[model samples]
Each structure stands twice: as structure tokens, then as C-alpha cells.
Target: MTSLLSAQESGIVLGSPLFAHINPRQLPQLLTQMQASRRRYNQGDWILNEGDPCQAFGLILSGTVQVLRDDFMGYRSIINNLESGDLFAESYSLAPGRRLTVSAMAAAGETGILFLQQDFFTDREQISRGGQDSAQVRANLTAILATKNLFLNRKLSYLSQRSTRQKLIAYLSDQARACGSRRFEIPFNRQELADFLCVERSALSHELARMQQAGLLQTRRSYFELAEQLPETDSPI
Candidate 1:
């Protein structure tokens, strides 16, 4: 909705698109008076770990951060990627005593975030009085959660297939469906996609090339164009 964060900007503006739809106007004066800070995390820097106390919530003002969880065997799986303008730790912000269930880290370059504390949301009376605004905020939250659930369902479908090629194809097919077209742009690069898909970068590239050669898809950088059908013998997974 807003231009990606600028390299020259040191911090996020309160009125930025990152918070545009969050309905701060419904917050009380005390909450609206909350302070803000900019934090920088280097590549691979851990922002938070699972089971850690949720001290503050943040928004990604710049760069990319990956939300992931590690299994008992120490294998990590990415849950999602937060880009500029995306909110992070929202559930933590709302639920003070809750523990973080996943870890976050800067995927590349330095990540910049806008942090706010629980004190910023202290005035429940104001929120209650701002009836329509509060309703809008609740509606927005519900819609976002619904979208997230849909995304999770799609991810599950993508991962259920056994074939690596089928997995990639399934992901592309879902993306196409989400965009309501055969041609669509992917939000992640090869490395990020590999992480999202739990595959090696080179392996993803090879598979993508193979898919294109097989007439199942076409790509120019992050933009992919999918065919309505795969090769006759490939068989849908």
C-alpha cells in the first residue's frame, strides 16, 4: 500500500502505511502518546526465540525477517516472511503473558523495525467509546486472520505431496489461483522461496528450470507465468 521503506529513512513515521489501517485513532490519549524506536538486526540475527516473554510488538519497516520454528531434532521450518510494512509480534502485543511460539531472524541485509510497548494500548475506555472505529479494527483483524488461515491451508496442500517437482508445481498453482490468473509475480526471491518451501536454493532453481522446459511454467526473475496444464505424463500429485 505504501512504497517500500527507503534506505535513507532512519525511522518509521507514525502515519505511515504500516499503521494506516491499524486504527490508532480509537486509542486513548495515553496510548496515542506511546514512544517509538528503531531497531536494527543484522543478517541471521535472532530477534526472538520460542517461549520467550513477549515484551514488545513490532512492525517491519525495512528488510526481511523470517518466522520459524525448530523441531526437537533442531530442524528449522519457516512459517512466514515479513517484509516492509508487515506487522510482527501482533499476537504478542495483544497477549502480554503469552510466549512466542516461533523465532524470528533477519533473512538478509539489516532488518529495521518499529517497536511499541503494551503501555501504548492501556486505555480500554477510549477504545470502547470509539465504537465504529473499534468495530472496524476488529473486522480488519478477523479478515487478516481469515486470509492467514487460507494461506496456511494452501501451504498444507503444497507440502502434502511427495514429489519435489509436484510440491513446486503445487505452490505455483496455488499462487496462480490466488492471483486469479495464470501470470503472477512471486513475492519472494529464489533464496526466500527455497526457505519458504524448505528446499535448497540450487534445487529450486533446477526444478524451476525443469518446469519451464517441460512447458509447465515460465519465469522472468520473480514473475512466473504458469500453464493451465502440466505435461500429460507428469500426472497431478
Candidate 2:
């Protein structure tokens, strides 16, 4: 069963970008106004389903959330995998009549999410009454949405690659850049990586095995080492 947002978890939310410039002392009132509630989900539990009304903006307080989409044939693809401190559903929350196109599921044990209703941001009367806090949240929300757009572009860069090797190269190279090293551990497993890359698991595995044999890269599970040239992708086009 889910419980109330604890003091420590509230601190995490207050520290997030969406809550930037918000005063800690006044956050309780803002939470009350926004009708914020905390919920917990076990691994594999669906937190939000596709076609559902997207009325709340969610913040991950703990664990991982996998944003996924499924086709009519029930094939699932991972749109994004978010971890602690990441925000979700902000765009949907801001859209008056939007429904979610993707479902969010817990990808780790006991993921905790704090959901704040959309009315607090949309209510003109509330915004007028809210003073600086409301204005700051509005600014923060804009920043969050803008950041999400950049993230979308980054994901597109990976997906737009012509081949599985190219896609993996784009993604792993970026990951290495982010970690400031050619060696790092990725968050996704083989299957999750395949889903995120929109490729068949067998194909992904086969490609990785080929790359390994060719000495382009080395991998033991999720850990990888690019031996030279940021060219873990030199194995492919």
C-alpha cells in the first residue's frame, strides 16, 4: 500500500527542477493546493496506462520508471527509462484534453512517485492567488518542458541511425560522453536495450556478439569499454 510523502522524499521533490525557486516553507501549502499525493508501485506495476487521462505531473522519488508504448499486436517498445529525480507527464498535464500515448511502469523494486494534479497550474484563479510561488512554478514547468524537448531530440538521434550498430554507437557514445569516459556501465540490460532501441532482441544480441568478436568493444553484461577512437561504432556504418 502507498503512503504519504515523507519529509525526506518531500526534500527530493523540492530539489527537482520543476520545484526550483519554490520556498521550502511554503511547499506544503502548494502541495495541498495541487492535491499532491504519493504512491508506490512494485516492479512491473503500471503507474499510468495509455489512453488514460493525463491529469497529473509525476516526479520519481525513488527507483526507475520505464515509459513504454505498445502496438495493437501487443509489442512493447521503451520510449524512455527514467530514474530518480526525473519528471514525467508534464506535457500531458499542461494540455487540457490530452490523453497519454504511452504507459509508465515501475522498472525497479518499490518505485515511489509523487503525482500533483494539473488544476494547480491550469486554474487561473489559483495562479492569480498564488503569487510568486505560482509564477516560479510556471517558469520551472516551462524549463522542464523545454528540457524534455531536448531529450526527445537526443532520443531521435539514436533512433534515426541507419543500422543497429549505428544506433548502438550513437547511444553508447553519448552515454560515454555523459560519463566522461570510454568505459562505463549502462542502465539497461540486453532486452531493455533492445526495446529502447526499437530492435529485435535476437538481432541486438547477434550484433553485440559480432562487435565483441571483432574487438570493437568489450562488454560483460551492462559494463562496456571502448578500446579506441570513440569508434565502438566503427564496426558498422
Candidate 3:
């Protein structure tokens, strides 16, 4: 565990969505009671490793982290990308003594994370005696978990497509709906996007070029515009 800064000294806005339901003035006390700590990670650092004991859950305060899973043969896949205010590993943390199934790595920038030990929330005495504060924290944790579950389900839907073009269309369509525009900037670049979609980079590039030439879409690096609607069938390259 890295040396941690006090919540106030860390400069994270307690009013962020993760803590929105709690009073800002009481954040410090809440953190103290929960035995939370703020830790920083440099670019490419591993914040959590697969098979490691998940004793705590983390909430991103700044920068980005990529959740990844690797098979026995060491083929890695990007599970998800988490940004500020996003929580990770809550399910594993809640299960006492369980090991993590995914590894979390800091993206290509500095990242700050707030970690709260599972025991802080699961201890029977604390839950029974701590009154409204503990209850609020538990409620917030439940809400966060529910939201993350929905996100994972959407990601699974995207990943389940059999064709690269279908995967691309599924991802782009979701992005369009999320931003409420036919044009939007995606977070991943070409190679990162390829890894995220679980496709060969060269194959993904070819598919993108084919789509652009067909007037289905226009893309410039991360920026994308849906020039025409995607087909209902899975279109393989």
C-alpha cells in the first residue's frame, strides 16, 4: 500500500457522483470511519493484479485505469476502462478472502485512487451500531455496484458480436446513443480500440477502411461520424 493523503488534503471533490449522496463536510469523518486511503499510480503501473486478494475496493479520483483479463496462454483482453469517480472490484472486495479475477492498470497517465477496506463496510458491529452514516455508505456502494453491472452487461453485448464490423457498429452505436449525436469522439485510439474490441489491429483497420469507403462511417483517429445507419445483420469482413 502506498502512503495515502487525507481526503481534504487530496483535493478530490467529495461532491462527485460517487459521494454525491453524502454531505461534503462529513466526508473526512466518513473516510476515517471507513479506513479509506488515497493512493496514486503512475502510468502503466498495476493497481491490482489477477489472483491477488481483494481486500479493498477502489474509486478513481483522477486519470484513467484499464481493467484487463488474460487467459492461461497470456492473451490479454481489455475488460473495461474506468475514469474518475468510477469504482472497481467491489464485488470481489465484498466477498471475504476472494481473489481478483481481473488486473487493473493505470493508463498512460498518472492516476489517483481512493481505497476502502471491505471490512469497514461488512463488519457486523459497525453496521449495527454506526447508524445513518454506515447505512448511507452501504446504499452508495449498492448503487455503484448496480450501475457497474449495467455497464458490464452492455460491454458483454458489444463483445458478443461475431464480426469485427458488427463489433465496431455495436460500439459506435452505443457511443452515439450515449453522447446523443451521430458524431462523437471515442476514448480509444486505433490500437487501443482494436484491443478493446478483441480483434486483430490490422483486421480492425481494414474493416474501418472498408466501412468508410462504403459511406457507412467517417473516422479521423478517435473522432467518428456515422454517415449511414448500420445494417441489421452481422456484416463480416
Instruction: Compute each candidate's TM-score over C-alphas.
Output: 0.70, 0.92, 0.90
Residues 1-237 of candidate 2: C-alpha lDDT, one tens digit per residue? 113567778778888887898777778777888898888999999999999999897899999999999999877799888988898887888898989999999999999999989988898898888879878988898888888788788888788788998888888888888999989999899999999898999999999889888887899889999767745343222
Give the C-alpha lDDT of model 2.
Answer: 0.86
Candidate 1 Cα misplacement greater than 4 A, ranges: 1-36, 118-135, 179-181, 199-206, 219-223, 231-237
Instruction: Encode model 1's per-residue lDDT on 1-237: one tens digit a residue.
Output: 112334344234334443345544333332234445568999989988898987676777778888888879766678887787666676776685799998988887988886766554545764466555444544654565576677777777767766668778878877787899999997787877776777777888998888889888899889998888853323233
After superposition of all CA atoms, the RMSD between model 3 and the true structure is: 3.5
Task: Sort every candidate by TM-score, greatest first.
Answer: 2, 3, 1
Ranking 2 against 3 by TM-score, winner: 2
- Go through the candidates in order and give each one's C-alpha lDDT: 0.69, 0.86, 0.81
Positional deviation of residue 35's Cα in model 1 after best superposition, in angstroms: 5.6
- Distance from true location, Cα of 96 in model 2, Å: 1.6
Stretches > 4 Å off in candidate 3: 1-13, 233-237
Where does model 2 exceed 4 Å of error? 1-4, 231-237
